[model samples]
Target: MRHKQVAYVLLRITIGVVFLFYGIGKFTMGRAVLVDGLVQQFAKTPLPPGLVRAFGNVIPFAEVILGFCVLFGVFTTMALALMGILLIALTFGMVLVPNPSIVANNLIYCVIVFLLLYLAEYNTFSLERLWKK
Candidate 1:
């Protein structure tokens, strides 16, 4: 494989593992705890409790599913797009809470996902590539 393809694969797998562990950690810690923590964290913010709760509930599942998709390069473009959307939502929530650090970190993730999407042509070592042949 070319250097660019190798680099892209490394980045994709690294981000995927990060997200996979993040989601798994949330589940292991209990989703209810995460929901409660989110509700408490956003209590003083302008965000609605119901929305926070719902997002908290869905985030873990989304992370795990998208993480696997990105890791395996299955529908890589779509997975990256969805990951971008998810990061946007997380960033919005952090912004509402005035958590600058997390917002900054999330923005970095957003940029990475954007790059992955934009350079998707280099994704030659993925399951999607194999399936096409």
Candidate 2:
């Protein structure tokens, strides 16, 4: 039982780190660059440029906030749900762009988020759990 909890915690932290760093990297690269890159990538797709830009504008902040929440086990389930939603949106866009590689990778992320959601009840080591006690 303890090992299962530990495994869940490790997976949560690992996913959090990946999202946190990816978001940080985007900011480091400059928001305009990131948004522009996204715009260009989805340019030929049916997705509207404005919609893509709006999503891009929020992606970094959402990733950072959600990543922190998951990392520290604060509202872990809710954070994971939001993460799943984000991944779904990303996957949708990738499919429109027909980028098989990224869509595949995003699907993997979706699986991880789903696993995290399932293990949320075992999140006894989280800050929220500790605080509740």
Candidate 3:
């Protein structure tokens, strides 16, 4: 194997593990609480109440699925793209709400997501690799 392949594997493993852990954390903490908190947070914005609730309910599951895909190195590009988009939206939400704490948290996560994207070509170690075999 090449040095680039080694780097790819290492980055893919690290990013995959992190995403999986984050997704598990969301589920472990109780989805309803997470949903309610999101709803309340969004309620402060001009976004429709019903839409907020609906999105709140949907996000957790999406996170879990996306995390799983990343963890397993399946559909890596699509999974990373979706996660990136979600993080960007989250950053926007924090900005809109002007919550210092949330802004800090979202910013950190956004950076992580961006880093993952920056390293995405390294995901050649994933299913995409096997497919090429």
Candidate 4:
């Protein structure tokens, strides 16, 4: 295989595994707990409580979808962009909460997502081969 092909395969695998774990975590452990916390936090912000809860529920599905797309190398660029944006938003929220520990994780994930976005062209290894033709 070519260097580009190797890079593409690596990128796809890395992104897929990361997102798959994230989606599973979101659905199984983080969503409800984080949503309640977020509802409380957003209660102090300008955002409505209902909207906050709704966003919390929707975000997990979004992550799952994006993760699946990355795993399959489908719409690689768009999925990376979406993941990057979500990471950025998460980092921002962590900062606003003034939680140093959470902020650290968020920042790290944001950087990782950005790196993945930077390498999105190499995510051409999977089913997206048809899309390339």
Alpha-carbon TM-score of each model against the true structure:
0.98, 0.97, 0.77, 0.77
Across 83-113, the per-residue lDDT of candidate 1 in tens digits comes to 9999999999899888999999999899889
Better of 2 and 3 by lDDT: 2
Cα displacement (angstroms), candidate 3, residue 24, comes to 2.5
lDDT tens readout by residue for model 2, 1-133: 5998999989999999999889998999999999999999999998899999999999999999999999999988889999999999999998998999999999999999999898777788889988998
lDDT of 3 by residue, 1-133 (tens): 6777677666656666766777678778887887788778777788777877777677777777887787678887788788878877767777877677977876776676676678766666676678879
lDDT of 2 at 81: 95
Model 1, position 68, has a per-residue lDDT of 92
Q: lDDT order of candidates, best first?
A: 1, 2, 4, 3
Candidate 1 Cα misplacement greater than 4 A, ranges = none
What lDDT would candidate 2 get against the real structure?
0.92
Candidate closer to the true structure by TM-score (higher is better), 1 or 4: 1
Assess the local accuracy of residue 72 in candidate 1 as a C-alpha lDDT between 0 and 100. 90
RMSD of 4: 2.7
On TM-score, the candidate that comes out on top is: 1
RMSD of every prediction: 0.7, 1.0, 2.5, 2.7
Q: What is the C-alpha lDDT of each candidate?
A: 0.93, 0.92, 0.74, 0.76
